[model samples]
Target: MVTPVRVVIALCLLAPFVAMLWVGSYAKVDPVFIGIPFFYWYQMLWVPLSAALTVTAYKLWQRDRRGRVAAAPASSGASPKGGASE
Candidate 1:
């Protein structure tokens, strides 16, 4: 059941958590952005980035759910190999 779309969705949702949790990567004062420190700016940047990623994941989830829902009836309606009884 591990599909490519599910993998992409997991990555999208995991990115922000990984980016924020890895403090050493952005724990700096140099490369200031319009007076804001790199640390602050980097963290703030993820706000929108996280939102976008979450939206993307949600849309993908909905699409995947729809596909599964559509396929469910077709799968369940089938008769056994011995055929159905009248």
Candidate 2:
């Protein structure tokens, strides 16, 4: 929710995508597997990696949410009528 935390989360999410692009662009890494090109294999590895990253991000988000909820102060008896000023 905080600025730096949000930036870190964004970077974490984008890292695998950048890695995928970098690996996919390589034209010279050879040695085919099951008739597929080496380039395909290398890029395909990101499938599971992406999934792992998603799980990691989800876990991190959950922990962040829990921490925020725990740290939040209890609601007072009287609620504010409308939006608050920054």
Candidate 3:
């Protein structure tokens, strides 16, 4: 089942990859910021953006994992009583 939450998490993880891979989109020297060229600043910006996206994805994955574990049946922890049966 493709839940909306899974879709959102996928997008969160995909954002950084897509942004970094599309180099030509931001490969420009104009529109300098704080003496930094667009190309440099654009790549630098993704550092924090990637961090945020990774954190979001991590949280979503943890939540999904917890839900699955909670819904699953509990396993018996008891060991076999007989050591050597004749």
* Leading candidate by TM-score: 1
Q: Report lDDT (Cα) of residue 63, candidate 3.
A: 89
Better of 1 and 2 by TM-score: 1
The TM-score values for the models, in the order shown, are 0.83, 0.65, 0.77
**Model 3 lDDT tens row, 1-86:** 68778999999999989999998999899999999999999999999999999899899988887776566554533223313333
For candidate 2, what is the lDDT? 0.70
Tens digits of per-residue lDDT, candidate 2, 1-86, equal 36666666677799787887684465655687788887778778778988887787777877776766565554633223333424
Candidate 1: tens digits of C-alpha lDDT, residues 1-86: 99999999999999999999999999999899999999999999999999999999999999998777666554465443324434
In angstroms, how far off is 11's CA in candidate 1?
A: 0.3
Weakest 10 consecutive residues, lDDT, candidate 1?
A: 77-86
How much lDDT does each candidate structure score? 0.90, 0.70, 0.83
lDDT pick, better of 2 and 3? 3
Please report how far candidate 1 places residue 26 from its true position, in Å: 0.3
Clashes by residue pair, model 1: none
In candidate 3, how many Å is residue 29 off?
1.4
Off by over 4 Å in 3: 73-86
Q: How many clashing pairs does model 2 include?
A: 0
